[model samples]
Target: MKQMYIPVNTSLSFLLISLFATIMPAQAQSAASAKASAATSTSTSTPTSTAKPSLTVTATQVGSGQMATKLVANGSVAAWQEATIGSQSSGLRITELMVNVGDVVKRGQVLASFDSEAVRADLAQAKAALAEAEATALDSIANADRARGLQASGAISKQQIGQYLTAEQTAKARVAAAKASLDVQQLRLKYTQVVAPDAGVISARMATVGAVLGNGAELFRMIRQGRLEWRAEVTSADLSKLTAGMTATVMAPNGEQTQGKVRMVAPTVDVTNRAGLVYVDLILPKDKTAAAFKPGMFARGEFLLGSSQAITIPQQAVVVRDGFSYVFKLNPDQRVTQVKIQTGRRMQVNGSEQIEVLSGINAGTQIAASGVGFLNDGDLVKLVAPSAAVGAAPAAPAAKK
Candidate 1:
């Protein structure tokens, strides 16, 4: 009205502004509605979830209360009585080799023999010398008798008779010396033959047919009476635990087993090793099936230190993971949960099969018997019939009384 007439461009500008205002409100309203719809949809949408992992498992039921026994040991088998058979005399050549290593021999069995030509010659010479001395002694005795008769009859001087008697006495002494020499030679000749002093299995043979053995040269090694002893070296602390007459089991290097009895506990400890020796005597089996045990065979021995009751599990049930032992336990939800366990000595079940367990398990608890390699913690599993999952869970404490 002040301008009386608006410019054409100004009117156009005002129309455009009014059109923009209307369009902007509609667009704003549309955007607000879209936002409201999006909010409602988001609120009503279903949520996503992660699925539980399924695992293969076996179940073990809780073991019942049973007496637990401990059998722990580390030892070696040794001969109770070992003899190194050596030659008593020197410069004897072995002429015959009768027994070799591992030959079972009886007491007084001839093992070997040396060439006895020189010994026999010496013995013959001693015998001949003894005969000559005896003849001379007899002649002297006759002469002495004649001299004594002459002296008594006053046909010779007393001094001359005394001289004859002295000669006779010297001849008698020579005869005795020769006879003693013959006996000594015979005894020395007997030493040429080597014989088993006791019934035992031959452990070693150092003498050959042509080898010359010296005095104290070891020709054979034997254990007396076939009594194989396990010489187990134990620490001083273990020595006190081991007593004579205790029973033990021995394992040969070839996996043969035998029973033995504790015979001796050494009072003195070896200064170099700081260990004492325990002697266990093993009886050789008289039957053919048990003849595998041999002397000088490397072996291990076990002596029971003591006995205690504790939880145990089969050796097959324990799983070693990352250098640690674990056993998967089946929970009530039928899931395998890993539980750490400490293992102990393997013992025979009812004196039959061996089972080992130390801790982290109890009797009559549900545990995974096998398939532990495919399982992890919190894995879902289906428990088979006869759940092996021992100690599935502890009972609730009477609902807090």
Candidate 2:
């Protein structure tokens, strides 16, 4: 009955409202279903976040131990005592040279020979003069005896007897002078040979064949007794720690190692450098010629000052980064915290190299013994028992049956 009076515009409006209501409900349901599907897919595809251990490692505790203490020094290898060999005779030519540089020689060993022809001729002349003087002395003695007999018989004047006695005295003086000249000539002859003053290894040679040398001219230089010493320069404060008879180890530039004993400590320190010299005599090896140590070689040495208590850890536990040393300390939660440390002397303990921890972590602190280089600060690590870690080495595949 109302439809009989309803306008066309009103009917269209009703129709649009009904259609909007139906479509809105359908779209809302579709959106809800899409949201539910998305939630289910996300719940199934997402992963749960769980932290994993970065590395599996072993732990060690810092312990107090005795480490050998040493004072290090830098210096040179030198001859214990150097002897300069020279020519004692003058105006002579070197006829022969028996030894060269690096030659081992003994005391009184003839190193060079000089021309002795002139000396021999002079010696012969001296001998002839001595013979002539002896003959003249005998004649003078006979005359003196005859004059004494004549004086007793009063057959000769007093002045004449005095003259005979004076003549006898003069002749005796000439004979003595001639004998002294012969002895002088013999000494000159002996000097013709240049001999070693002491047993040593020759270090330098200046004598050449046919080269005339003057008195006191150097011919060869040698290290007396073939001995070598390491002269280490140490700070004055540490010099007192070194004493004679202390053991020292010297390392040559060529990585050759030799043991030495402290010979002496310099009484005075250098004013400019405030350092003193510690002379250690090296115990040369059996084959001296083949020895790598030589004079004037720069070397480094360490003086053993005995053992002292120190906090130490295995060398592998320490890590060096950016020129600074560090160690990873383990926390109660099995996490590693990087700790910078000061390291000192390295020593062998129980056949393992241990490094002295001067400061940083204290004794009883646990640290990552190995695999530290691969770890970072505040990293979680898994720990295995000592026996388990040893057995963890990759086992070989079983042999074929």
lDDT of 2: 0.89
Name every residue pair that clashes in candidate 2. none
Candidate 2 stretches greater than 4 Å from native: 1-59, 287-290, 330-335, 349-351, 378-401
TM-scores of all candidate predictions against the true structure: 0.64, 0.78
Q: TM-score of predicted model 2?
A: 0.78
Give the least accurate 10-residue stretch of model 2, judged by summed lDDT: 392-401
Candidate 1: 10-residue stretch with minimal lDDT: 392-401
| TM-score attained by model 1 | 0.64
For residues 114-186, what per-residue lDDT tens digits would candidate 2 score against the true structure? Answer: 9999999999999999999999889988898899999988999999899889889989999999999999999
- Candidate 2 shows a clash count of 0
Best by TM-score: 2
Model 1 bad stretches (over 4 Å)? 1-82, 88-94, 143-156, 210-218, 270-274, 286-298, 313-342, 350-401
